[model samples]
Target: MADKVVPIKEQKLMDVKLGQLPSWLAARDYSAQGIFLGFKAGYDRFFNKYINVKNAGIGGFAMLMTGYVILSYTWSYSHLKTERIRKYH
Candidate 1:
């Protein structure tokens, strides 16, 4: 008699503990193509449509960081100039 091999069907559901959501979201699932595609599309749409705050959340953070860097550089240059003047006097 020949042995029969039972094949397992691939499932879309990802298994994990309750507190592992961020890790799970970072992980890639090659088995669930449909679910992953849907999730990506939904996430992109949500970010595009639901993000109504004009330059006040993620964009605001980016702008603030840039402004801070620029202002810091300007301040450093001014402080160095003052130091040079004091040294020359």
Candidate 2:
């Protein structure tokens, strides 16, 4: 008798492919989830469709927004004031 291995299918959700993806990502187990999620989310340059606030929670969103505001303000202040400070006498 000869030994052989058989594969089993687990929890697969139905989806439609909008475009073709490379075979490498399909073969990679670790990256498969990310690829699936990215497609589901409609991965454009901006405006990602799958904005999961429930998963992130209010505090997480707040912190992220706060960080964005703080960084932007700092960048603007630095660029707008740098030349003025150098010229001040």
Candidate 3:
């Protein structure tokens, strides 16, 4: 009796989609539990969705390039201003 292992359910041909996610989210608005669930959803997006097997390489590369561009512009803003001043001088 103790050796039984339960397998996860596989997708079937006619799967039924459940409740409206938006309505459910709206129902939990501004409460502590809602905030916790929001954090969990954010973590799931960043960790699970972003780093998944199918598009992980492309998605990660795109994200890295975007971050690099934004940070590069931000970090070099002062230098760019100096160059602009030097050019106009």
Counting clashing residue pairs in each candidate, in order, gives: 0, 0, 0
Give lDDT: candidate 1, residue 85: 60
lDDT values of the candidates? 0.61, 0.51, 0.63
What digit string (tens of lDDT, one per residue) describes model 1 on residues 1-89? 99554322322235444566555555545568868897897667656654645653676456557878999989799777877766553
Better of 2 and 3 by TM-score: 3
What are the runs in model 2 whose C-alpha is more than 4 Å off? 1-56, 79-89
For model 3, how many clashes? 0
Q: How many angstroms is residue 84 displaced in model 2 relative to the true structure, after the best TM-score fit?
A: 11
lDDT of 1: 0.61
Ranking by lDDT: 3, 1, 2
Q: lDDT tens string, model 3, 6-58?
A: 32232221332354444444445488986898789776777676676565667
Runs of candidate 1 with Cα error greater than 4 angstroms are 1-57, 78-89
TM-score of each: 0.25, 0.27, 0.38
Deviation in angstroms for 53 in model 1?
A: 4.7
RMSD of each: 13.2, 11.5, 10.2
